[model samples]
Target chain A: MKLWKKNIWKNTILIVFGIIILLPFFWMFTTSVSDPLKIFSEKLRFFPEEWRWESYREAVSKVPFFLFMWNSFKIAFLVSLGQIITSFFAGYAFARLKFPMRNLIFYIVLGTLMIPGQVTLIPLYSIMAKFNLINTHWSLIIPGLASPFGIFLMRQYFLVFPTELEDAAKIDGCNVPKFLIHVALPSSKSILATLGVLAFIGSWGNFIGPLVFLTDLDKATVPLGLYRFMGSYSTSWPELMAATAISIIPLIVMYIIAQRYIIEAYSFAGVRK
Target chain B: MGKKKWKKSEVMWGYFLIAPAISIIAIFALVPVGYAIYYSFTDYSLFHPPYFIGLENFKELFADEDFWQVVKNTLFYLIGVPVGLFVALFLASLLNDRTLKLAPLYRSIYFVPVILPMISIGAVWIWIFNVKYGLMNHFLGLLGIKPIPWLTSYEWSKIPVIITGIWQGFGGSTIILLAGMQNIPGEVYEAAKLDGAGGMKMFFRITLPLLSQSIVVVTIMSVIASFQIFDLVMVLTGGGPGRSSASIVQFIYEKAFRSFEMGYASAAAALLFVVIFIVSIVQLKISQRITNY
Candidate 1:
């Protein structure tokens, strides 16, 4: 009887908390479908009385949403692919091979994690400008091609890999690069997915990078597009909500498909650090 | 001689493998930082040549009222860190209950905010904090209360952003803390229960102490994140009602891009780096002490 009572209390609390956390999301969806003129009605309706499906159309039409999404996708895909390649090679070297100044170099890489990106923002901008890369996708892709966190995660993953497989590969005349490509990478699907998802999520949602680097509206990413929409159409709540809903649909889908890996990756990073 | 050559080749292979990553870091991160340090000591507007004016920008920043206000605003924003930690820890403990069914569902719901883009969510929050017909005011009105200006008022502008920060951050921290809680051995809890310890006592003594490392990590990360807050401020408030909610990052952005004062902006960025470095070092020492205990 006591155990039953405790369970009841626990569940009740959990449900209430869940509702609070979910309220904004519910509001976002409802507002997306809500009548713009009626959104400010004194009695806030949880469900839209008239589903204004046109808001989504209007939101898309008001801005180049698809263009923005394409821009985001392009940057995210390249950055993820670049980060994986660079991090794999670097992680392999740091984990499986001995080199001069190895520890010192590893420490330097780790120390970069502490330095916030803002510290290098101005000078990087200047460099990009000098190279005439500003307003180009290369500005977004090149700087983020390698990340300390990605390398660190990859190194940690590599360290735990069984050495016997590598030794066997070596005995079979498999050189380091060949073994990495044929053996190690094929077996590292899970870590690769984790790293790819993390990098994609990061670059996709990135605001400041695109905001600073890509000044053209045609080249703006989703976040920047959404921000521009809000700026120009501040009073159009329904349109704004609709645009937000559309922008998040892909992320929501990605999260649902790989929720476990995403959550575990984040927690692993946090706890290990 | 053959063995030595093989060892040398292995070393060369290692260097070759790591070369790309190191070069990228050196070019994009290290070189830029070096330039930033140098730029902070010069007066470089985008149009003109950078001339050395040692300490001038720093001197100007020290005397700038707007900069000081941004500093205060940033410090005020950090209140979200402790508040977020507490909320995350509480939710984590609740979800950690083995008796709870659908815990994953509940967790996924809470985590929804974290996965969404901050800029998009910031837009959604703007509506929620809307003065007249917003959900927050509507909820308050149920208890016969008047609506408070959540994002418009100078005094109230920071509150909504802070709440949003906490909300968005709660999930990540909860996951980390929950992982920490899971790592604590069941035997310790069993022993505490065997000694007739109450639930609250066990939590304070056993759970919190064991979870200290995660707590420290979450807090420091939260602090760093909050310090760099720009998206939310830009989207939600635009640091408005006269720069009341402007963060240092926002200030740097405006200075660098809008005013094209690269030197002054670099100075601000460098100072912000110092502040973060100090806080991180202090937190690391504190966490180290706790872990030792």
Candidate 2:
């Protein structure tokens, strides 16, 4: 009986804490669709009493919603594709190729990781200004196309790959890019997915890069787009939350679809370091 | 050394493949770092050409009370790391139970905050933290407590910012720590159970001690992350009623972008680099030492 009680207690505690952790999200969601008057009422219920979801339509029409989403989508997709290609290419060179000064070059690339992004912010802004690229998406996309971390992730994987395959391909007269395209890529699908998903999520939700690089509301990504709405309609909690929900709903859907790869791969590899 | 003849195609392909990545890094990452260091020693407005002043920026930064206040606030923000970790560890321990049938479902719920943009988090939290007619004070009223100022007062502003951050942050750490927990072999628990170790005893003696490496790694990474906090702070309190809640990076942002004081901002950023670099080195050393454990 004591053990049964303890087990019950443990389960109850877990359920309660989970609810507490989820309350803010619940509040955000419930408030988004609730009436504006009820949102301001003294007694705010946890769940919405009515679904006035034109708030979604209202929020969407308030600004360039679709344009913001498109910019976000374009940036995230290009960043993922760009990082994957570049990281794979660089990773193979660092891992498999026996060129002179390979180790030295690899270390040099990795050493740049020590410099925090803040240290580079001022000069990057200046460089972007020099080239008249400050307000352009190219400024955002170019800086993110390659990262030492992504290269390191790929290089680590390729380092332990079977050398016999490489030697076999070499003796078979298989062309270099062809081997990577057919052989290496097929083997690295999961790791590549891990990188792609992470890159996509990071780029989609990014605020600082867009905040610094892009100035126009039309050019803004989703997060800053929502923020721009908030500045104007700070009093309208329902509309703001509705906009907020719209921004993250896509990411949430993707996360659910790929939770298996994400939690397992990311916890061990991508985000931790 | 076995002088195996290198394939002409292989060496040429290597350079060809790496060219794009190398070019991007050279222009964006490498050059920016060099220019930042140079700018730190010179005075340059947005319009004027940079001129050498030789530590003028650094000297002004040391005496600036505003700079120190931001440094103090950023350090204060570090309190969120350990607090968030404790909650995450507790939650992970609960989720560690084998009988928890819906563990994955529950974990996904926890991780939702981590994947959301800071702007979304800020938008939701701002209404919740509202002084009058807010969800927080409404709850306080239900319990017969007075509504306290959450985001307005200089004294109490950091509390709400830290709480929101913890809410967003603890989830990711919980997920990581949960993965760490599973990595421990099942036999250790069995051995402990055979020795008649109680649940509490096993947690302290077996679980925590074994999980210390992961705990340390997560904690150090959290420290590094706390330094770069910007969008969240901007949304939460806008660094507050009078700069009481501004972070180090926010300080840099205001100086560099808002005021266009490139030299002063670079100096502050240089200091930030030193702080993070030191923390990162400690992380590297500690991580290397703990890998075998």
Candidate 3:
């Protein structure tokens, strides 16, 4: 009876804590649908009586929502695809290839991770401006294509892949690309998915990249588009919340779809560090 | 003959495979770092030719009061990291109870905030911290407590920012801890139960100690991330109320972009880089010791 009593108490505590933990997001969702005036209505309502769906409709119409989505999709898709292809090949080379200065080059790549990206922001901006890449998706996509973290994660994953199989492939007269594509690529599916998802999620939610490079409203990503809705003098709380929800919903959806892969990526990133 | 040539081509291909990565790092990452370092020693605004001023920028920064204030705010935000991380780890352990029917749903729900862009989170939080009609004030009112000026006052600004940060952040740490929990052998718990250990004792003795490696890693990452926080501060406070809540990064941004003091900004950036480097090395050394034990 004491043990059972303890269990019930523990469960109640967990339930209460969980509710507290989820409250902010719940409130955000509620506020998104609630009327601006009704937000602080003297009689508090946790749930809105009549959902104002127009906030979302107005948010979509005010900004080029589909264009922003397309721009974000294009940038993220290109960056992720390129990052996977480049990081995979480089990871394979580091993990399996015979070459002098391999470890030295790998160390250099790892060292870059410690150097904060903020240090390079202005210089990179200048360079991109010089190349006339500013206001274009290439500015964002090109730099991210060679992600050090992806390379590092992929290298660690590739290192554990069986070398004997590669040797067999070579003996069967398969070349490097052939061996990598036919044997190595198929085996590293989980890690690749993890890397791809991580790269996609990061590229999707990026603000600094689009803020610095993409000056045109039509060229801006979701974060930048949302920024347009905000003003220095005042803010549209309900509309801002609506836009915020819309901007984040796709990421939330992607994360939900690939939760297992993302969880594995977190472990991979955490332990490998 | 063709096979011999193919072997040679394969070796070259390996080098070719890494060329794009090396070039990207060299052009984008390396050059910027090098330029920033160079600019730190010169008196260069964005529009002017950089004149070599050799440590003048560094000298000015040593006496800068605002820089110190920003540093203090950063450290203030950093204090919440360990508290938040451990709380998340605690949450993870509870949800790791497989007997719980909705563990996956609980984990995903907790993790939802982590995936959201900081831009959006910052927007919602700004409203939440509004002095009047804000949810926080209204909620606090229910208890007959006076409303707190969350972002308006210097004294109160950073605390609210830290709260928002903790709310958004704990999810990532929880997920990582959950991953660590899965790797531990189930038999350890069984053995503990056989030895008459209950929930609290087993958790303190076994689960936490076993999870220490992951905990250390999470703590270090969280600390680094917290110190370098930019977006939330940018949107919410603009590091305002007389620079009381300005962070090192925001200070650097103002110095570089707003004030156009590129040389001094670079010096500040370099100083920040050194400070972060030292902190990271110390953190790594500490984590290394934990792992070794």
Write model 3 residue lDDT over A84-196, tens digit each, in one string. 88899898888877676778999989999988867887677778878989889999988888888988887887788877998899899998889888888898877787788
Encode model 2's per-residue lDDT on B82-154: one tens digit a residue.
9999999998998887766777787887887888788888888898888887778888888998988988999
lDDT of each: 0.91, 0.85, 0.81
Query: RMSD in angstroms, candidate 1?
Result: 1.9
Q: Is candidate 1 or candidate 3 better by DockQ?
A: 1
Chain B vs. true chain B: TM-score for each candidate? 0.96, 0.93, 0.94
lDDT of 3 at B265: 85
Give the better candidate number (1 or 2) by lDDT.
1
Candidate 1 lDDT, B206-260, residue by residue in tens: 9999999999999999999999999999999999889899999999999998899
CA error at residue A68 for candidate 1, angstroms: 0.6
Q: Which residue runs does candidate 3 get wrong by more than 4 Å?
A: A1-10, A232-235, B1-10, B186-201
Better of 1 and 2 by DockQ: 1
Looking at model 2, residue B99 earns an lDDT score of 68
Model 1 chain A lDDT-worst window of ten: A229-238
Q: Chain B alone, model 3: TM-score?
A: 0.94
Estimate candidate 3's alpha-carbon lDDT, on a 0 to 1 scale.
0.81
Give the interface RMSD of each candidate.
1.2, 2.0, 2.2
